[model samples]
Target: MTSLFVDRRGVVLELESGAIVFRENGERIGTVPIAPLSRVFLRGDVKLPAALLGKLGEQGVGVVILSGRIGRPSLLLARPHNDAVRRVAQIRLSFDEPFCLQIGKTLIERKLTRQIEWFTELRENDMQVRYELSHALRALEEHWPRIGHASSAASLRGVEGSAAARYFSGLQAVVPNSLHFSGRNRRPPRDPFNALLSLTYTLLHSEIAIALYGAGFDPYVGFYHRLAFGRESLASDLLEPLRPLADQFALALIRKKVLEKDHFSTTEAGCLLGKAGRTRYYAAYGEHSETLRKGINQEIEWLTAQVNEIMATAEDDVRSEDDFEDFG
Candidate 1:
């Protein structure tokens, strides 16, 4: 699956025959074929033809329009499913409290365990991390047992937030200070290296959200992530298991110091990635996306197995294979 990321500033995206031409500075420097593509991300002031979007939709490729400075998706174009009932059923099943919560708990717990495991491995080299990892593990261990008893999404989310805070603290501490990187912040990443990491991670999250939506999950309904305006809570829930990959990608880039200060810019309001920064981030994102997609597909396969087992044990009238695939 290919995700075309467009972050070039002041570029024009126009359909030329069966391909897209990218024109910059009165020159044609790029062309992308409208084939073998899964998604397109429009992230700049580029313009697109209406017919091209229609063709992309017809090809079962997703197109997302993103606004600059906002850093969130603005619009999406995708092919309509012919089997509407199946898609609708998937959404309902994904939103069902019992089913969604159970699956979410499994996902979060697995991810928490992975984070703990990674922390332990890291602590072997850095003794300072021991205290924080121990605390994080303690909280995760304490929080996991309550998943089964959580009555509302809020309770589960609280558990997740606590665990995440501890984990992020440990992760930030492990990085050397020479990189000029600090812990996570709400505003755009202040440093160039952090900006690159953030941009790539955001792109990865957006791609995962699209996949979750295609899977028929209610992207807004979630177990571990709180619901907020324009927040894809369900996507956040599903992304727990996939974060380590992005973390690894960021860590690699930072260690190499491939990102320089020139890659980023700052405004009075916030920092933003420049053209070169976006290009490098997108390249990394494409590589990271391939790895994460395979992992997600594997997770889906595992879930399918568990659902199949449930169907096998339940009465045929109560549980059917049809219902199993709906959530898959």
Candidate 2:
């Protein structure tokens, strides 16, 4: 029902009569009922009993461990849906060129549309940045028509990239000059805004992946994003339209000064959010997470219905072919 975030170091977690008790320095710090938890996010040096892991899994509570300075996440997922047929349908659809193209167009169209709306809203409110926002808005609008006309996945991606470039350019105009945010950059995320973007996107991706697994969809098989090793392509596909949401959230953090340049430390590796900053970030995210999850759940439900329809139609087609053969 809710997510629990444990970001402190040296906190030991144990299961006590169906609740999770957090201990630090041999003293009980807190206790949380497991019944209401949908996921747990653990960062840094937190320790948990193995028995708690089993209980969490049994109760369908996903555990996300954010490790290292950059906070790379690893998931201990709950049991996935038992219906393998949905995954089979997903895999089959991935190979369907027309279906893939249509889905790709749909995803990009929705994303660009949201970007256009956001910039348009900002253009009205932020007079100082109107010129730049107008320029980016025009580019996004021009690309909008191209999505409907895209005949292949490669071309669709090209349009999406160009649109994204324009969107970020517009976004750059809104960010404070001190943040030094330009267009989107990642892997190291050279700027503070990009770092926030990367962190939020990572969290969003993990949430969608968990939803996909629960719905019996293979997170690695995708319609818009091609399959790649170690990549959750399906999750990436779902994430496309929702990126504007994450982008907006990140921008809010910077604009409101909840996250600032001082909250980050840069090394050769990349810019990393400091511990205090992360604690604040997690708290802020927890407040916004309910809205994010509602959007994710809506997407998941829509996708589930679409996959079920595809599977039914395929089954019907197979039955028709068998009947024809028997008649002959």
Regions more than 4 Å wrong, model 1: 25-27, 124-152, 178-182, 187-198, 221-229, 266-268, 299-315, 318-328
Q: Per-candidate TM vs. native?
A: 0.78, 0.96
- Give the residue spans of candidate 2 off by over 4 A: 322-328
Among residues 3 or more apart in sequence or in different chains, the pairs in candidate 1 whose N, CA or C atoms overlap within 3 Å are none
- Model 1 accuracy (lDDT, Cα): 0.68
- Cα deviation at 194, candidate 2, in Å, is 0.6
Q: Candidate 1, after superposition: displacement of residue 106 in Å?
A: 1.1
Compare the candidates by TM-score and give the number of the best one: 2
Top lDDT model = 2
* Tens-digit lDDT string for candidate 2 (1-328): 7889999878999999999999999999899999998889999889888899999989988888988877888888898999998888899889999988888888788888878888999999999999999998988899978888888999888888888888888999999998888788888888788888999999999998888898899998998898999899989998998999998888888878888899988788887788888888998898899888887887788788877888888889998988884435
In candidate 2, position 2 carries an lDDT of 83
lDDT at position 172, candidate 1 = 70
